[model samples]
Target chain A: MNLLLLHPDQRLDGDRWRLDDRQATHVRSVLKLAEGDHCRAGLLDEGTGQAVIESIKNNEIEISFKVDSKPVFALPLNLLLALPRPKMLKRLLVDAASLGIKNIVLVNAAKVDKSYWQTPNLKGDLLREKLLLGLEQAGDPVMPRLRLAPRFRPFVEDELDQWAGPGRRLVAHPGPFPELPRGLDEPATLAIGPEGGWTPFEVALLEQQGFGCHRFGSRILRVETALPALVGALMRLP
Target chain B: MNLLLLHPDQRLDGDRWRLDDRQATHVRSVLKLAEGDHCRAGLLDEGTGQAVIESIKNNEIEISFKVDSKPVFALPLNLLLALPRPKMLKRLLVDAASLGIKNIVLVNAAKVDKSYWQTPNLKGDLLREKLLLGLEQAGDPVMPRLRLAPRFRPFVEDELDQWAGPGRRLVAHPGPFPELPRGLDEPATLAIGPEGGWTPFEVALLEQQGFGCHRFGSRILRVETALPALVGALMRLP
Candidate 1:
């Protein structure tokens, strides 16, 4: 953990902040911070703040905090990804959140097996578990909104317009195309397909809705691999 | 495996090629290739070629090939990374290869434990295994050359200059200014520190040698997260 993240609710009386087992153990063992040593911490789902080490005993580490700063607003990129397998999904969720993605929409694709949708990772508690890890990695408090839309067609046809941040909408496809827009001047919503990639019809449906189709390169990238490359390309734009 | 990769030496007489157990099982089971069926195959450490299923009944499936095109080269960037733990090292090796990185210099960092350098993943045979997997993922034949330089200073001061491609050099460090060159048009050799990031002294050495210090924003990213991001950014430059 780069930074110790705390939530507003974790604050007890006055300056004292309560930490859970995982955070406590990390502070105690991994970081090995002694009392009076200063470490950075942020309010979970709130703001970035500094935390002073007050005491360490048992599995709990009590921290004292000062005023909270305004939380960082993420880049207005809405990543629509076909959820990868469980392990990769966990890392992607955390990485996306840490990278300041404002929102993520996990959808089912033709290449996605039905079983992946049923994994325990989709559960609210489980999803939050991963997102929190992401938040901690980012040193941000506010969690990016997460949505699971199992039905691909309705979500894209109906809900997409409402969710897109305004500007370009691109889908990552491998065959051939003009280069994807780099350093997009405005906010964008990028759609990444599953590991096996979207079926031809799925790509066609997205394209019909004004989503430009572009390939990163001739090389095919995994869903997670495509995320940073596409997001970085957009970051370079404008 | 999207494509079966074979070394140039692996090519045999007429329509027959020797098959390893791993490749044999993958062909017979996963791909389910039967007699007379066609599948994509390429020459390892060389070029891409086509393979036809000549027979499939025995313990090994014999295949025939038509020598066609050479494999694509990697992006201009050469990855110089601080050795991570075994699992992440495996992923990094594979991903770098799949993305067609020609050379990877795994060096020590202050934050990287000595044990990580001793990981079996760093061993020759194991490293080859990961690179082959990466080659298969890209449908490319050439495996990236892995170089080990235990000490950071000598490697950076001596060998790095020789191995540096004809382009810019940048180190991914979190700090003010020294933003990554926008629209990098040159072939660059980039270095990334371990998860904890490079030390101030290390960053200074790189800067003294005209290596630009670049930051991918404020959030600290996993080593894996940063690789493709850097690749995408470098690809967009100039």
Candidate 2:
């Protein structure tokens, strides 16, 4: 963990906080930090700062922190992704969060397996746990918002228009579609489909809603790989 | 498996081949191909074509193939990566291969764990297995070339200069380094450090060998995420 993340409630008195959970274990073991040593720390959804070890006990450690930096800014792009398999979902969540994506909509797709939504990884606590790990990795304090849309059509026709707002809407599809536009000046909502890609009807539905199909060459990358590639490419726009 | 990858020795006669290994199982179960059914197929380091199922039995399947298309071209980029942990290495290999990175140099760094070099995943057969999976995913026939440099100093002093050639040489580091140059018209080599990043000495050594430091902002991405992100961003040049 690059940042030691502490929840709001973990504060003790004015800048001083005590951690006894995994963070404490990590501080004591992995970091092997002793009194007077400093480590990067952040309060969840608050800000980042430095934390100096004050005291170390058997199971907990006390530290004093200073909040000096604002939370990492969120990206201008929102993501619309087909719900991946359970294992992939975990990694995608962490990656998406680490990449500074603040809003994510995991919707159903034609090729998405129905069983994926049933995985325990979708539970709120479990999801937050993974996102926290991502936040810690990126040294960010704010958590990305996640919304689940098990139905593809209704969500697209009803919610996506408003959620996407005034932005370039692009769907990642493999075909002879045009390359991603350069210098994307406006915000964007990028839709990534399932492993086999969106069906014709799905693509048409999205296109009707102003989603332009963008192809990243012919290589079919896994969703985890594609997410970063597409995000990175889009972020590089001018 | 997106493409059915066949070994050169798997060919039986003119335009015909038989398989009873994992590929056969994948064809029979995962792809569920029946007699007269066609699937995408490619010969290792050769070309891509279509394979039509001729017969299917419990353990083996026979097929007729045609070589029609050349392998997907390799990217005009080489990668120098500080070796990642074992589990990450597996995914990195697949991601690197799928992204069309043909030449990769996995070098040791001060932050790299020595045990990473001892992973069974580094075994030739296992590494090729992962790379094949990546090639199949991309429907590309060419296998990426991988070189392992367990010793850091010697490799940099004696080999990296020649391997990197006369292209844009860049090291991905965090700090005041300038953003990656745009419109990269020539071939380039990108060096990415391990999780903790390259030590000052290591970066200086690489700098001495003509690698310019480039920073991709402040986000600390895992090697798996960073690889695709950096590759994607670099590929977007021009």
Candidate 3:
């Protein structure tokens, strides 16, 4: 873990915090820090700073934290993803979090296997756990909001405008099309397809919603690879 | 498989090819093609077109091949990567080829585990197999060149200059450095450090070798995530 992610509930007092369970084990074994040594740390949805080891006890470690008051900035991007397979889903969740995307909506697509919706990996807590790994990986404190849309048509036709807010609406498809437009700090929602990609009708549906389809290149990229690539293509973080 | 990859030696006669083993099984089971069916197929490092199934038998399938003469284009990017863990390596190899990267040099680094060099996945034929999967995934014909450097100092000090010929020489790090400039279709080499990133000494040495380190925001992305993100940040495919 790049940063010691402390939960809001873990605070012992105003400045002191207690760490236990997986984070405790990681600090004890992997970090191998000693008393008085400071490690980079931040609270969930809080700014990063340093935490000094106060004591190493039997079951837990006590530490004192001093963090910057600045809030972690969320990227003005919303990822509208076709639910990938379980293995790829795990990787994407971690990446989406690490990349600081503000919102992710996993919508059903034509090629998305029905079995993917039934996988345990899609469970609420399981999904949260994956996103946590991502946040810790990037040392970011903000948790991204993830929503599921099991029905593709209704979600796009009904809830997309409000969810996407106001910004660039894009669908990333194989290019020979126009280049990705320059990014604005305002919100952008990028829709990526499933394994075989979106059908013509599906593309038209999203197009009708003001989602301009853009191309990265002619070669098809795997969904996991395409997510970060397309994200990088659209914007750069400050 | 998006494209059924065929080997040149699989040709039974002038225009007919016989497919057996894993691919034949895939065409039978996953693709579920019967006699007279056609599938998108390509020869390794050759053009992609169509192959019509002429016959299906007990152990093998017979098909007639017809392919375009156009060569698959390689992205003018060389990836200088620290050897990642085996699992991550497997994913990177596939992605590198799918992204159409021309050259990848896996160099030893202070943070790279020594055991990574000894992995069976790094074996030449095994590496070839992974790249093939990537090629098949993208329906691309060209295979990326993979080289191993077991020593860090010599590889950077001795080989970096010649290896990274006539293009932008860069190292990716956590940044608020500057925005990545627009891309050109010329050769560029990007060096990415290991999981914890390069030590200060190593970064200095690379800096001395004419490598301008750039940043992709403050988020420390995983190597697998960073590779594509940086590659995307550098250049977009034509």
Which candidate number has the best TM-score? 2
Residue-wise C-alpha lDDT for candidate 2, range B1-238, written one tens digit per residue = 8888889788899999987488899987888888999999988888989889998888689999988998855777899999999999899999988888889999999999888898888888988888888888888889988999999999999999999898889998888888866434469999999999999999999999999998885788899989988888777522
Model 3 segments more than 4 A misplaced: A182-184
* Residue pairs with clashing backbones, model 3: A45-A141, B45-B141
True contacts kept of each: 0.41, 0.58, 0.64
Scoring each candidate complex against the real one, what DockQ results? 0.49, 0.56, 0.67
- Candidate 1 per-residue lDDT, tens place, B1-238, comes to 8888876565678656766678889998888878888888887766767788887667676788865887665667777898888888888887787777888899888988999887776779998898888879878787788888889899888777778857888887777755666445457888889888888888877776668887767776777877776677667521
Q: Which ten residues in a row have the lowest lDDT in candidate 2 chain B?
A: B177-186
Query: Of 1 and 2, which scores higher on DockQ?
Result: 2
What is the per-residue lDDT of model 3 for residues B1-238, given as tens digits with 9 covering 90 to 100? 6787888999899879998688899999889999999898887777878899998887589999877765566889999999999999989898898888879999889999888888888889988988888888877877788999888899889988898888887888765555564454788888888987888888888888888878777777888887777777678675
Give me the TM-scores of chain B across the candidates. Answer: 0.93, 0.95, 0.93
DockQ of 3: 0.67
